[model samples]
Target chain A: MKILVIIPAYNEEENIVNTVTTLKEKCPDVDYVIINDCSTDRTEKICEKNGFNYISLPINLGIGGGIQTGYRYAYKNGYDVAVQFDGDGQHNAEYIHDLVKPIEAGEADMVIGSRFIEKKGFQTSSMRRAGIGVLGFVLRICGGGKITDATSGFRATSREVTKFFSANYAQDYPEPESIIAASVSGFKIKEVPVIMNDRTAGVSSISPFKSVYYMIKVTLAILIYRLVGKKWR
Target chain B: MMTDLFRMILLGGVLIYIIVIGVLMKKGKMNLKYSLVWFLTGIVLLICAAFPGIIRSFAKLIGVYSEVNVVFFLGVCFLLIIILSLTSIVSLQSERIRSLTQTQALLEKRVRDLEEKNEVH
Candidate 1:
């Protein structure tokens, strides 16, 4: 199967090289693309210097848009499966194969590499964990299946799901919202336990001040998707 | 009762608003399609100022005590509509921009790959 790993990077100069290097070393056979999201820092320069496969967006498309671009690339290149790996070094590259296995076997259309299943790795803070719990409950009520880590960015998509995302993706707070979208569209969703690390470098995208807004936005997005998401045959 | 002075002032304001919109359209700062709404708003205000009785009667029909209050109500409603339309326009533009950026990035990568291949040859 032709698999593509998409690393969406924005101002991730500190962690970009390490993330890409680890992925290359761990998954030598997998093709990867680094989406340099119009960073103000030296992310693009680093990608160019290291000869990493990267795409520099002309404008900042935010996290959701950046990942959608990756899906678009994957679809255009005829990739059978695509995996989203964070550029912040929080996601492990070793579990990529595990993430893709369900999709390859046609058991699931999307496989989320969840950190809460085994309750291993960085479990995040209590406050954030509570928020994620609430989101998980909301997803369950919305018929989005039992997603343990609703905010896990580590996920793999089958070609059909990848195409769906390329055509329609939430611009803000996409992680939880997308699961609802896929489920409503009648796509199989599964989760596998995976270990993650605390981001070693660079600041997190979600700040404390934004967390409240993030929670409300994601919850609403989930409900909205449930209401409007149409099943694709 | 609408005072003559207030009527003159309202007329002047409406004219100035229309003129400003015309200038913006001429300078290409605003699309004519978008400016049409503003123009229609200006003309409606012009009609209301020219014949204050229209607003007075409408205010009575709506059970508003004052004609000025009716004007304010209409103004608020119009502003809300314009703001909502502006937001929709922004959403459409951003979506288009995202599509364009993705296409451009993919094309750039393909060109770079072709160039690299030529170099290897």
Candidate 2:
């Protein structure tokens, strides 16, 4: 399958190159694109110097917009599958195949890489895990399936999903929301076990105080999607 | 009971507001799509100001004790509708802007790739 790995980077100059280099060494044949979200830092310069394939957005659209740009590229370029790999060093490159296998086999429309399924690697903090657990329960009850990791950025989607996301996607903190969108739109989702590493450099955009808001907002977003009863497709 | 001078001031104020909106529309400072709402609002207010008896009867029909309350109610409702419509407009414009940015970035990369291929040849 023609798979495109999308790396959404925002002010990730410290980790972008290493992440891309690791992906190149690990998955040599897979095409990849880095979406530079108008970083105030030198992330774009590093990509240019390395002769990496990237799109530098004119303005910052946050993570959701950056990923949507990648989906658009994949759709327009006739890619059969698109994998979302974080530009930060948190996501391991070796497990990318595990996420894509289901999509390639036509068993699933969207495949999410979950850390909780295997209970391996950096499992995140207890507080964050609790929040993720809450989101998982909410998705299971409302989204009609059990998604162990609703917040996992490491995922692969078939061309149908790539086209859907290219036309419409949530703006900020869209990981959980996108899952809800896919499920309500009648796309089958699957989860595979994958080990994740703690971000080696740079701070996460979500701080301790914001996590509470994130949980509340994401839960409300998922519930609204379930209740809206609109034909998303 | 409003004095004659107060009613005259209200009439003049609404007239001036309508004229200003018309001037803005003519100068292209405001889009016709948006100006139509404001213009209609101004006209409604002008009619109310010109015929105070109309408001008094409507207020009476609605069981409102004071005619001024009717004026305030209509004003608030009009403003609320205008604000809601503006919010929808902004939401649509932002979506369009995002799509434009993504397309522009993709096209720029395609051009760069073509240029590099020419250079290699």
- Number of the top lDDT candidate: 1
Across all models, the iRMS values in order are 0.8, 0.6
List DockQ, one per candidate, in order: 0.76, 0.80
lDDT of 1 by residue, B8-114 (tens): 99899999999999899889999988997788888888988999989999999999998877877888888888899999999899889889998898889889999
Q: What TM-score would candidate 2 get against the native? A: 0.97
* Residue A19 in model 1: lDDT: 93
lDDT of 2 by residue, B1-121 (tens): 5456767887899899999998998898999989888888888887778888898889889999877677778888899989999999999999999989998999988998899899999
Given candidate 1, what's the lDDT at residue A91?
95
lDDT of each: 0.92, 0.90
* Candidate 1, residue A146: how far the Cα is off, in Å: 0.8
Interface root-mean-square deviation, candidate 2: 0.6
In model 2, state the lDDT of residue A71: 98
